[model samples]
Target: MASKQHRLTGTQSAIYLIISITLNALGNGITVSLNLGSALWTASAVNLSHLVGGDLKLLLMLIGFIAIIVNMILLGGIQWRRAINNLVFMIPFSILVGYSATMFNQWHLDNLPLVLRIVLDLFGIVMIATAVSIYQRVNILLHPLDDFMQIIRFKFFKGNAPIAMWVSFIPPVTMSLIAIFISHRIYAINIGTIFSLLFQGSLVGWADRHVFKTLKHQGLDKLMTAKHQ
Candidate 1:
């Protein structure tokens, strides 16, 4: 019952991809603004930005490019098209993150009480996990961080989203920890970060099963083929 992936036409898939991207950016914006925590990758970028003191969006894009190299290593070869696509994916995503964060900052989300912020942060994580589920299934082009999970999920875990998601988190968590060690201060690791580490994988798995159940993972055979190349 869970294995059959519903097919989406090209247009349908594109629409889903767009929706997921927007949802992801909005969630990221909220989490970053609230300072309650963020998805691991976003947290890593944020902590690194505090240290580096540059544009958050550009820093995120740089981190995204680095992730592309890691993804290539996982795939066992350079996937030029996939790499290029992943790079392109960052442009709109980073812009959206910047805009969303700006909008939320105007709303003063960070000024809210701790309990309210925590609840909103958790909701933001849900949006991010849902976005990951939708876009990974679309499999057209992907954010490199999510692409890492997709490769691990299908190539190593045989479509086990939870395991793959957990596996994918290791790098970002390490990145965040290193920033903390160097700065001797906490930046982005907070309640939301803890929530994501514990529940994000399971959340993605649940979303894959329930959110847009018709949109099955696309190009799995090609991914399998990429494994040997």
Candidate 2:
């Protein structure tokens, strides 16, 4: 059985889910605006979007769906209930990402200076890291990729967070490499992707330890606990 202390009420979970998805969308928008590629999964989706001439948001939805299916298979059976729960947030997440991408494209930030672009990229990365940390703490329905990573980590890595994160990078990096080879150029895997691969885990780990600790100290965790009870 799950620990009552770690479980959240429906309302609390909904609030955290909205915050996590919103931050994720904001990060996606900033990354798109930077024109410097995105973190691993988004970079893969971007490359696929280029290849198929499809919208990035639609591709993300498809990718997320596939991830869930794959995860279900890996776990040895389908759990329709769990899958539906995941899709509840996944659909909104895709929509938000798409909307944010459109908004950022309309902003014309691509014409900015290299320094400004780099700064925005860094900011986006921080937002994404922070969002990921919060999502983990919420302990509710997670993005499929994140869910898959957690499953793999515990099953194979003995719950080693850092190693799990690094291992999770392999698939997207492989996809990016394939995209590069096919295009004979770099489309979505660039400096930002490299930076994410190297530093995102450490950044998220730090945020989990310090940033979220601060939030807990401020009584957010207590509120969730109270509501849950």
Candidate 3:
């Protein structure tokens, strides 16, 4: 009974992976193409690009590697399996985000009015939050940063998703601030960012309760129990 609830089969894992990754890409694509405001971490990377003079792709990849390091710290040891899974997820997800951004740009989403773009940005955040909820529960492969959030949620915050997510923002928020201080310019910080900062994690928590309520977090037992591995 409990095993059945916790078990996610091969087919189920594949299905959830496809759905979550696609949704996440589309959501992030909307923000990147529209140039409105991205989720905090991505925004921080963009802001830092102003000062660092590197490809956005490279910066994002670097940010992901940093996430793995942070995840290692959170887990209290180096978990190579999780780190490799994160990289595997990151590569494909990054590809999808790039292609989706190109498609959105081709569709002229970037031309929308500020008001409409703002609305779309909020909607994009919704999609992202929902994607995070789905993939976290799927527990197959996750974005390292999302993994970081999950670790925080269960490990420190007693499974409080909102507070965990808010805490996870500290590093990226610091990156953005440092970049802004050095560059004297902003890359992506707007109403949409404010909305995400205030509500993205809450959105994730809401999705956990309201969207696909039957999907248990597969593999959570090992994750939450393994003190250092």
Best by lDDT: 3
Q: Which of 1 and 2 is ahead in lDDT?
A: 1
lDDT of each: 0.84, 0.72, 0.86
Off by over 4 Å in 2: 1-6, 49-58, 214-229
Number of backbone collisions per candidate: 0, 0, 0
lDDT of 1 by residue, 1-229 (tens): 1245556788898899899999999998999899887778878888888877778768877788888898888777778888888878878987898899999999998889988988898999999999988988888779988898888888889788778888888888887788888987777788999899989889999998899877777777656655422
Residue pairs clashing, model 2: none
Candidate 3 lDDT over residue span 1-229, tens digit each:
0135847889988998899999999998998888877789888988888788988878888888988998887677778888899999998998999899999999998678878988888899999999999999987799989998998888778778889989999998999999999889998888778888999999999998898888877666545554444
Give every collision pair in model 1: none
lDDT of 3: 0.86
Candidate 2 whole-model C-alpha lDDT, 0 to 1: 0.72
Looking at candidate 1, the ten consecutive residues that score lowest on lDDT are 220-229
lDDT of 1 at 78: 75
* lDDT of model 3 at position 192: 71
Worst 10 residues of 3 by lDDT: 220-229
| Ranking of candidates on lDDT, top first | 3, 1, 2
**Candidates sorted by TM-score, descending order?**
3, 1, 2
